[model samples]
Target: MDEVEVVVAHSERTTLRVGDVFLKVDADQSRLDVEVAAMGLAPIPTPEVLWRKPPALAIAAVPGTALGVLGEPSPASPAAWAAAGAAIRELHDAPLPPWTSRSVEEIRVDLDRECEWLITNDVLPADLIRYNREIAEIALRPWTPVFTHGDLQITHVFVDGDKVTGVIDWSEASRGDAMFDLAILTLGHEEHLADVIAGYGDGADRDVIRAWWSLRSLTASRWLTEHGFDPNTPGCEFDVLRTAFEAARG
Candidate 1:
């Protein structure tokens, strides 16, 4: 295409926005399958599917700017955050996806592995790692699996004014803990937490959500690094981890 912009380029996938079309290129067909299925099942607004071939799926761009960016304060007003929160609540209240989510045991194993890697590489203070791990244990308990947009990063949401226009990136959508989605969306944007919770109405556990902040930061650093983004960048994942540690100590 004459005017193509690479929105995301990582080891796992590449997302290119050409004009009004978004082309996602991934080697894994199974993930594409999940994306297509999840989009079909989601109760909220999502990108329109233009077409799909192996290794690539093209979707019509939704109208509006992204809700926010990672490691940055959301430009969206509190009302936008609230609108996004309502969208998530609607999705969570829908029927569970056909696929299974990560078990607590599976998460614990990954946590242990990532924590060891972080310490071995001298990525953080050992005490910080230890404290976060202890705090993270609270989120490992059983939860009622909801239909979650597994990677609900701020960039995945589209908004016009205070209204949510669409949500994107459904590959990670599955039956999972609802708080995990909430945590992922609000990570690194702590100021918006109350806004989101206000929109969500009730029955949220802030402690568990914060625990996920620690757990996700601890586990995702390696993958993010391999994907070209530096998780250690100031005000990013490392900062999130440090924040979690301080909160636990207080």
Candidate 2:
């Protein structure tokens, strides 16, 4: 019998690993629908779907390990980081998905709301929240839409040696800013930004990417806390914000 392992469980969904297969359970079927559709449309490799039953979707585990974790140093070589960047460029260049993503105004509104919540709830220092929010403002500018992996977290990308094998968790995939995807991939892994840009080619604005770092950290900290995650973990969102603050001060 394959031992069932709990991968992640939150108010919105749960993921379980049974042998080589991963099962995702979400109350919202639309997300599952999008995941299936995105994987099918994506140019890069994605996990093979084994089966789907209403609220549950089963997929064969893709080969290779995740590129890295949020709060840890990546052991992957610079070439592997570049490879992941190349894969992201390929995905961004593909046809736009049918679903539209949150507009810049929507994101700005959300950021303001989350920042207020962070201050009111004492989730973070008011000064820190204010500083990061100021930095986040630059990312509110308009951008060209692309086929983006909405939640392109470092762990979502899998690579073997220097080659990208698959990218997972496509529920958030949609027509969105390409920079947002790049920002998410390098959120806590700023050290690899140069390598990633090398493979992604030109026109990656560092200021916009850095602004997204602040925007993402500020907006996501509250949700992460509510969802049983610690944004204060070393080298994570809070740390990223602090680093930004320090850089601005000096």
Candidate 3:
């Protein structure tokens, strides 16, 4: 057997890949609980949980390359992106999960807190933070909660051809704003937005989706930095923030 590959190791959790199995070791039992339950509830394909032994949950690997990577152009076809959109739509249409989701007020509070930290620490300019925060506020309105993959980064989705093979990293899954998922999936991949929305078909709000994009990038940068990632890397979270800043100025 091959040695275990470190998929991701962060302050919050660690994921290891050992051949056909993925071992997720996290100290937070609640997150693990949500992952397990969400996997069971999601209508789309998800890795089957092989077994669990506290602090570590093992699941069979989903067969396929990731749909895309952050900070890089996606090699996936438009069809594949659309397929992911369709899969997401199906998942959102499913019955709401039992878990609670964040309210608009809660998200606003966190966004304000994060923006303050970014400004105080000089992580970003005050104007940039303020501008993006104002843009993000557009999304802080009431929303009907649906089953959402809270952190639907492109890397979490696996695809073979134009079909969605599986979706991984379910710890953030919950009943939440559907546009939040759409925004996360297409975070830096803006060109693919039309394709995704086309597959999603109807009731899609572009403005709200863009608002979530700004909100997600703003709130995620500090954590990503602490977790050994440089959000300032071209085409990453910080770049997304910069783009928002430029647009706001224009």
Candidate 4:
């Protein structure tokens, strides 16, 4: 928390620290299709498992001025979202696993399970359950088990010279539908979400992407709220997720 020149981030326990070595885990499960800059790849950075004991830790690679700069974009302006969208498209194109420990059906079900946690904890709007159910009904059918970032968000991506220089946090990386990745990137930035989606490869379906985005947004929001995280905190991902939920719904 003092003055330091370098910092490290842990995937399992986030809260970056100022130090030479960074730590992260593979979670309690498996992650695939993950890469790190050390592997000679750019535009996508995955955490390198440096220590896999007790609480897993990994070495992280990042670019200058990412997350620290850019802040949040005004969806009213297409330029920011446009570029971010393109970057995400490139990220989606990055390699990922074709399957995870769970199937697409099971993963889709997690959205409901996450929301239910919110309801059981009395942290979600009661109507959220039905709203999400409708979303699932429409979104669940088109899922294709393919490579996914598992958790994709603008924060995880880094840009340099108009190119995505790096992408971070791979514990969530796994095999799933591309829409899941799309959902993570465009959930709240819906105003510009279209621009981002438009920039994506022609292979993806918009309707499916929107549904999953909406579902994941709600699931992530409830998670933060339940954990007592400040929803309005600046740079707080929970608020971002909630915003994505609204955007996807709209």
| Candidate that scores best on lDDT | 2
For each of the candidates, the C-alpha root-mean-square deviation to the true structure, in angstroms, is: 1.1, 0.8, 0.9, 5.1
Please give, for residues 1-250, the per-residue lDDT of candidate 1 as tens digits: 4698999887788999889999999989899999999999999999999999989999999989998888777789999999999999999999988998778999999999999999999989999999989888999998988999999999999999999999999999999999999999999998998988898889789999999999999999989887788987777899999988787689
Q: Stretches of candidate 2 above 4 Å error?
A: none
Ranking by lDDT: 2, 1, 3, 4
- Residue pairs clashing in model 2 are none
**Where is the poorest 10-residue window by lDDT in model 2?**
198-207
Residue 117, candidate 3: alpha-carbon lDDT: 93
lDDT of each: 0.92, 0.93, 0.91, 0.55
- Backbone clash count, each prediction separately: 0, 0, 0, 8
Query: How well does each candidate superpose onto the true structure, as a TM-score?
Result: 0.97, 0.98, 0.98, 0.68
Error of 1 at 211 (Å): 0.3
What tens-digit string does per-residue lDDT give for candidate 3 at 111-189? 9999999999999888888888888999999888989999999999999999999999999999999999999999999
Query: What overall lDDT, based on C-alpha atoms, would model 3 receive against the true structure?
Result: 0.91
Q: How are the candidates ranked when ordered by TM-score, highest leading?
A: 2, 3, 1, 4
Q: Relative to the unseen true structure, what is the Cα RMSD of model 3?
A: 0.9
In candidate 1, position 223 carries an lDDT of 90
